[model samples]
Target: MGFIEEFKHAYAGDETHHYHVARKQVTCLHCGGEDFDRGSALLNTTGLTFLRLDWVNREAHLLICAGCGEIRLFLEKPDRV
Candidate 1:
């Protein structure tokens, strides 16, 4: 699976538990890992969108692989289930 499937798996499990994935679940570039921890990073810019002020400045959502420590970033946050 790619980020899509991996993300789905992560949010499907225990809320407080670490992500659990199988082989070939998460891969990007030369990165390969099964589990990930999610978070956000602030982008250096100006403005705000959370309050519908502007889109010039926004945060990037990301997932860090538990196995290889590789970080995957997305312009839009992944959906949660």
Candidate 2:
């Protein structure tokens, strides 16, 4: 598999879910897919992880597309669809 495929599988654990952003159904920008796996990502700074201060950074909700592994970051939690 390619890098993107590997990355998606590495983080694959949550059950697949459907979500919506801004009242619009979430679609994978890369693959135009609608199924996703919910995840969260920390908006880390350049040197925060090494400094052991990464937790101080903000977090964005993620929706990993099941079809293309495309990740979407949201400042606010997306509504379930």
Top candidate (TM-score): 2
Assess each prediction's global lDDT (C-alpha) against the native: 0.48, 0.69
Expressed as tens digits, the lDDT of each residue in 1-81 for candidate 1 is: 121222322344433213322322344334554456676666443323333535633556666766666777666554432
Model 1 spans with C-alpha error above 4 angstroms: 1-28, 46-57
> Which residue pairs in candidate 2 have backbone atoms (N, alpha carbon, C) closer than 3 angstroms, thus clashing?
none
**Candidate 2 C-alpha lDDT tens digits along 1-81:** 221211222244656878988898999888889898887755546445555656663555778888888788666788877
Q: Candidate 2: global Cα-lDDT?
A: 0.69
Task: Report each candidate's C-alpha RMSD, comma-separated, in the order given.
Answer: 10.6, 6.8
- TM-score of each prediction: 0.48, 0.66
How does residue 13 of candidate 2 score in lDDT? 64
